[model samples]
Target chain A: MVTNEDAARLITAIKTSSTYDFTDYSDKSFCRRIEKILLDNNMDLNQLIHKIGKDKDFLEQMVKDITVNTTELFRNPEMWQTLRYHILPKFKKNRSIFIWHAGCSSGQEIYSMLILLNELGMFDQAKVFATDINTDMLEAAKAGQYKYRFNLGYLDNFDKVIKENPFNFEDKVDVPYEKYFDIDKVKDTIQMKPFLREKAVFRKHDLVKDGNVFYSKFDLIFCRNVIIYFNNKLQSRVIDMFNSSLNRDGYLILGSHESILGASANNFERSKGFYKKKQM
Target chain B: MNDYKAIMIGGSAGSFQVVSRIIAALPANYPLPILMCLHRLKHIRSGFVEALSIKSKLPIIEPHDKEPLKAGRIYLAPANYHMYIELGNRFSLSTEDVVNHSRPSIDLSFFSASYNFKKKLVGIILSGANKDGALGLKSVTDNGGLTIVQDPKECQVPTMTTASMNATKVDYVFSTKQIIDFLLKLA
Candidate 1:
């Protein structure tokens, strides 16, 4: 029911009421989050305009609500399998491989990559730069403890990836998946291996505002699922940022369902699930 | 279901055949966006969409995060995530935790659609082993949306349909063939 005029008005109201500027964020997802807040609070648009001015807590909650910091370990195992067999091994040839897991939700993908690298016996040479805009999620990622059960299917994907004959080298290295986790008997959840947790460094950075991450080009950058919460313009901008951020021939892994369509498709050469920035 | 913007139908175990039946009946230019969530294996991604599209006339898409919801198309909730509707008629997916042990959860999508679409939602719950969509169908009714539950007698698994009937007063109860016929009228 919201029109462009209403969205512009809401943006004005939010900017006037709070210090944060949401004008650059995707309007579609932004409106949805606002609508959710309206529904949860049982308030209409007019009431929302008034409440944001009068109530500070509502403004704070709205920021947290809009930032989607939800992800699972190996969320899409096929993507991770690509990382395991195809991507990570390519990076292994380098003495010290650097990775940036932009918008790493709860460090699931980070840990997944680390475990894969560990299995390949190259984890010691890799450093994972995992960061998020949300501090709460960043802390969770740093903690590297998960309450959810590590699904057996996640392990199954690892096995399938090992069997895929990675790098076409003909020799496949096998590792037991259970060794990566230390069972928490009381909580009934799994905490990732301590050795892997030490390798991932978590930080807080907004993908929209942060111009450069770490000021060093990375061998591989994972910006999966993160770009989908954006409009075409923002998506293109982020993809360009990622393209520049990667070293030549470096890979960019997106979500399984996400593709670099339209203008963004030109930034990288597609190889099925993998997108490699062209060597200039 | 007057002036309906979207049609949401969700199901679980034993629901594939029912979903295929509905899709086979929908024409190429069905007016409203049809979103579906069927419980599936978490790791298997590619085959399901291809399987669903085999007999469907409408172009079936597994929505990327924040993809705009469009008319005359069908959207499937992808694996290992719960798809939600934003007020502006776009899709948002979250992977907080699996609900009712099912990602791409039926209830999560239904409840969100109920809130977003409100009076414009047509919610349907079909054959399944669990009670995932029961409360969601209730939410559809609460928000003045239409609710349909497959007849338990005709369901491959009746736990979900029976639970849905027990949860709230639904607007319609029909067999698979009758459900297809009803959807045909809307198309």
Candidate 2:
């Protein structure tokens, strides 16, 4: 296991050797991830830091390993229901709906959004942008393929959010799963349809250091499940950035379990499963 | 004894009634914050805190990610997430893959709390069907903190307490009544 001092040393080594800075990450989570990495690579903190300082390939791999990338299609069903019934309709009148998926790991969320937009007939009017710090995740997002068995549970989320209208029990839509993606149970793969895969613009962008890389005010920014890894200072900085990046009354949707803390939370009015930028 | 900054309790299976009774016994003015990591059904997000709150004088909460830890309150690990007590006395939640077949793994929570508070912390393990909290209780000892286990002879399920005893030499093997007595002494 890595000690707190060893974690600090590793963070500093990574910062000095690369442009990445983890100074503002939650210390406990960072240390735990490092401990896992150390165990997996069969190296102590000193050896890991030594390789980080010397080998670029090894350093890149280490950085990627440090990032938590477990994501599934429509992970939170209720949040998607809120987006579908309540949030999306509010933006329907707008000619172009700008949606940004910041820290969009593995792109399940972006596809999730696209499927929703297409269902609502708002796809043509939507401009979607996705970004992540991990280039590997970006590539995986582009491929838009996931394990069928592993994500089988989340497929229920798709049905809950898409096919069934919660407001009316009799209002059931017969939308087949193949309409959005192809599933091969024998191969254990779920591949996003080619059109859905190509809809979003994917980029490699770091949330900590980068500032509004898209340079457009978004109507809805989904930074779900991403800010939990950040410390209060970094969370505030990112929240402030999201506050600025959003249009007036724009939505900032986070993971169900995540909420804004500190003074930065003042920028948004809390709604069910999401936050709306408060009008100045 | 009064110098202890926090108390961490890990339990599962038949531990709820034990925890409820302990919390019911604690006064509202209890000084140290109680951190609990109990194995729970991941999909059921609500009602756990409300149920736990029914018997306690202190406020029971499933802490949001990065929420600051406060004294005189019971912080239950939220469903489907790992809760950590960070160095800054704030709570950080993680959706990282499950450990020991549990998302809110007892070992992970105890590890962080023990590291943060060191000798100023007290770790307790209660009735559990699994051995998740064994290494975590050992971590408390490793970091010079006090460790306790509900006496296995008195536990509904003895695996966790037994495993913890085999993992490290705990400071106390208290019954439910004795555990309450130990906490009240701290207050």
Once model 2 is optimally superposed onto the true structure by TM-score, how far is the C-alpha of residue A241 displaced, in angstroms? 1.4
Which digits, one per residue and each the tens of the lDDT, describe model 2 over residues A1-280?
7777888898999999999999988888888899999899999888988988999999888889888886778877878888999999999999999999998999999999999999999999999999999999999999999999977876788888889988887999989999999999999999999999888998888989998988689999999878899988899999999999999879999987799888998889998968999998
Q: Please give the range of 10 consecutive residues that has the lowest summed lDDT in model 1 chain B.
A: B90-99
Q: Model 2 clash pairs?
A: none
Report per-candidate TM-score of chain A alone: 0.85, 0.98
Q: Look at candidate 2 and tell me the lDDT of residue A85.
A: 92
lDDT per residue (tens digit) for residues B1-187 in model 2 = 4499999999998899999999999998999999999998766766888898899999998888888899999999988789998888989999888999998999999999998999999999999999999999999999999999999999999999999999999999999999999999999
**Candidate that would win on DockQ:** 2
| Residue runs of model 1 more than 4 Å from their true location after superposition | A1-19, A22-66, A148-181, A184-189, B1-6, B25-33, B43-46, B57-59, B66-73, B85-90, B97-101, B111-122, B134-147, B162-171
- DockQ-based CAPRI category assigned to the predicted complex of candidate 2: medium
| Highest-TM-score candidate | 2
User: Which run of 10 residues does model 2 chain A get worst, by summed lDDT?
Assistant: A70-79
